[model samples]
Target: MTSPSDGTLVAEPRTDAWEFGDFAYGLEPLTMPPVGDATVSSALVPSALPPCNPDLVLFRLRLLAEGGTPDLPDTFTDPTDDQLFWFRWITGHQISFLIWHLMGEILERNTDREIPDRASLARLETYAYGYCAMLLYTGSCPIDLYQSLIRPRMYLQHRSFSGTWASDFVPVRGLFRGRGVARGDAPEAAGLARAVDVHKTIHDGIAARLVPEGRSLLQQTMKETVVRPSERTAILYDNFFMTLRAPVDGEGITSQLLRRLDAVASDVAARGLYPLGYGGDERPKELRSAEVAHCENRIGHLLHEVGEAAATPAKPLS
Candidate 1:
């Protein structure tokens, strides 16, 4: 008769091996019959089992991604303190500036007049700034529940934003029409897009390999706690692109501009995850770091491209 332990699936196994789905019946351990014909009793036991609650990992990620406050920390009473200042800065000022800049750039190119009305520019800037601030405040949170919560939601959000940005850029080619500026002229956009493509490449490449490696590290460092370094990096990368593509105008802002601003705010949100003082203040030494310097150069190049694109003339939409 089948009993618990030998081949039985009862009494609950370790958390890692527990399968949330079907529970196998307990079977007695016994020697198999000859190879001529193996009976049901002779079936081989599974060498390994899937995790019990995969959702738990995703849920933890969400908590960490959305855990902090913009104006005040839930646990801290000080309102003016910057202890969580990075969080607030990302959600508030940075994003707004990004959106306003993008809007101004787009509007300046599309509008016929050489000089746009000051009032309109002011209004656009205000709206873009306000929305960025709001987004920063709302999106900035702690990393307490990242493994189970934040990662899954962020994955979905990242996909949605990526799709939206691609779709939006299709029609805007008209804004860059004329002025002999070939699509190739915006090499920086192409480069940024390439960087994003590489980021995704690394993400997919390391999904199984790096994710578990990172999780193992976290488990070692903080028992019972699973950290999602890959997911965090992905979200931050998304923010960086959004900011990098922020719209700009010589005049006022527009809705298109706000969208770009949101990108910067998102970048700030992503960067906030890193410890504030982790990078030392040695400019030359710091610049030598490939990853850090690459990002700085990329941002600078992208900004220059956008600025140049804005300065080019556009045929009015008939």
Candidate 2:
């Protein structure tokens, strides 16, 4: 890939694995076959099992990727102000913002437009479905769920006056056009719809695991927020490209981000799982950790692909 650096175009070689789809099932959880000698199933090891069903992973991932406020389960007990805040933070704005940032970055790289600063690229809209599909199919980041404001949420700040700012969203109705989706639909339109579906599933799954009060609280919150029907895709392709402006070490920025994300996920599982208690059925903890890790891996993999593609130099004709 090529990019201008001090008036010189720098190029990097591309890898066979440097594609968004390459990471779709990159880090699936392993299910071990029972072993006779060790009594420990190989399933416990992530690498032991074959890759997960790409279709199902993609399905569950759709839920995890596009999280929102309405996805929460019903509330059983009243939430403390702090708990409510965290719940909101986890289920909505922050996660949506991060996904937008990633999608924007991809669009910017492909179109040579500054995505963060502009709105609605007529040119990129044609490829919107394909791009949106790839992002939904490949984008995942568990760490983003726990945090608020991944990229300052400023990209769409100016567009807030336009139709409720990411509300009233309707999913692509079906695989065919007029089913809530058409060939010309904006990327974010289809993107947000899938996000809502996935978010709802996640809340339901979590609520089922928690105690009665916990489940009730989640359910209550879930019902409180209602998404209005959206007229068009809320955020559109822009020309402004985003930059971290942070110093890059020996490894590239993508590598650094992945490393940091890995650490964050590890720390979360290490501290978060303690409540489950030692020897208190590690399966749930392991499964949760693996799932979170999978999401982190998908994000890291996509970023690496985007970074490389952005830097790819034009090849000379033979």
Candidate 3:
């Protein structure tokens, strides 16, 4: 097994890796797409989207069925450190593909069906945290690269492509705003509420660091009209993450989520989250530490908590 000590992450299979099919009822991959590939980025085009968000859990299942390999950049085994830097950012977005849709499922069930037990909600929280962790990795890209390449590509999608306009997430905005069924007799609800707030906070911090000018996305885009949440915006969000839309079973969603989660955990463990190192001086003081060691430590900690929450929710998080 290739330990993380040397930081040469060729990626070996983990012995303790979990098979989500055995316990598919619960929980998330790590890879990047080919650079400058117009074909894979079709989610940004209005003509490419479905009338509504496709069941993302199904999309994941389809990927697994096709040999469990998601899209990849031209080079995987070896790339210059500079190229790997951007690869991490792209991989971060790729992993986030599942996190966004899974949260929507949790919110829908809370409002429409029997309230979920704490364990289930807690497991859901791990996915939410995984989303936050993805945001962190995205910001790991240097500001110069982000502005020169990443920001411009996003502009091609929409002038004001804000997170608030994700169609599936629009109905649940109150939860992040502290107006949802967070408290009352449901402690799990409150925990989820907290996770949402944290996710937003981290998002804001990342934006500030990456775009220190403090310009709103709208301001940056130089557009005044706020795009409403609809199929358009939903597709735009998925396009940014390069998620594919496909139909799959509702019950299969849980199994697929768990499968995706294990793949990501195994991949990151084998190759530390920010293998090149935390973008030094670019990272925020509150989160950056030990140069590179801090982020590697954090990656292990966050994923471990998420895995524990999904695999053994009966136990308390450490």
Candidate 4:
């Protein structure tokens, strides 16, 4: 994880990690030609449409096409820390992880209409490993218990919560369920149904929105609780999007962007938070504390270059 004083990342050859070069040209194309209803054989003529925001139409099309083969970020070279964080965050929010979890749940419950994509079934195990790593990093409850408590709670939250994107999909979901009624004959109805499934799959796999116990512990512990002599509390604000907008370089922005997480983890430990029975500890109390300490150390070492890297976008690769 150590980098030169100039803040240039060592750029270790990684067999298991994704390099920046891999995704250099992988962004989904933004422009989409006018599309007709899924059932319509003909494409819609753009000019024939009434005056409306063409930008919005393009945006929706782009959003639908955003899902590509998921891969780790280029900066994920160090296994000790970067991979841990990447794995944790991906399983918690990534679409790949969500769909996989939902399919597994449906199979386990032996629900009807359980159409399994045997080809993609392996992704479930991959995400499960990441999910387990996330639990360990966040010091959350045991995997099974966390799933039991979190899934149903999140399912309800997805329906009722208005602030999140999940809530916006509720109408579409209802439309899907009632497709046999008014829209049954529409050509696009099947596409709408698939969209509904994708929407629910993502909502069901959210690990960030935990059960009451997990949420309470995380919220309380993540606050600026550890007041330093300088009166600074350990708080790691999410600057990910902003950091993304900023220029990136070969030196790697993660070295500076996520540096605060170390302090946050330290603060959580210093406040004696490890032994709390929030999600139920599978390991002995001592081992749990040790793991927390280890997680924090790994986070600290992750992308730990000697110099500070400015938030900047990288130039196009030659």
* lDDT against true structure, model 2: 0.28
Worst 10 residues of 4 by lDDT: 229-238
Error of 2 at 163 (Å): 15
Residue 257 CA displacement from its true place in model 2, Å: 6.0
Over the stretch 56-145, how does candidate 4's per-residue lDDT look in tens digits? 322322332232222334553333233333333322232222222233332333333233233222322222222223334443333444
Put down candidate 2 lDDT per residue, 155-262, tens digits, no spaces: 243322221233212121131222332222545445433433333333333333332244332233346654332322232211111111122221242232222222
Model-by-model lDDT, in order?
0.32, 0.28, 0.50, 0.28
Off by over 4 Å in 2: 1-96, 107-200, 207-263, 272-318
- Report the number of the highest-TM-score candidate: 3
Error of model 4, residue 122, in angstroms: 24
User: What does candidate 3's lDDT look like per residue over 1-318, in tens digits?
Assistant: 244676543333322223321221112121122111112322322121111112432343334333354333233344444454454555455545445445555665556534566655776667766667777666666677678777776677777866554443444455455554543346547766666666666777677777889885766655567555566666566566545444433333333344454445544544455555555675665344342233334654554454334333243222
- Work out how many backbone clashes candidate 2 has: 34
TM-score of every candidate relative to the true structure: 0.25, 0.25, 0.59, 0.23
Residue 286, candidate 3: C-alpha displacement in angstroms:
4.9
- How far out, in Å, is residue 261 in model 1? 3.4
In terms of lDDT, model 3 sits at: 0.50
Write candidate 1's Cα lDDT for 1-318 as tens digits. 234667654433433221211221111111111111112221343222222232332232233235321221233232222334433433333333433344434455547743334433333323322332333232233333233444444455542222222222223233223221112244423432333333333333323322344442224435544334343433343353322222222232222232232233233333442333222343223223454334333432332233333323333443
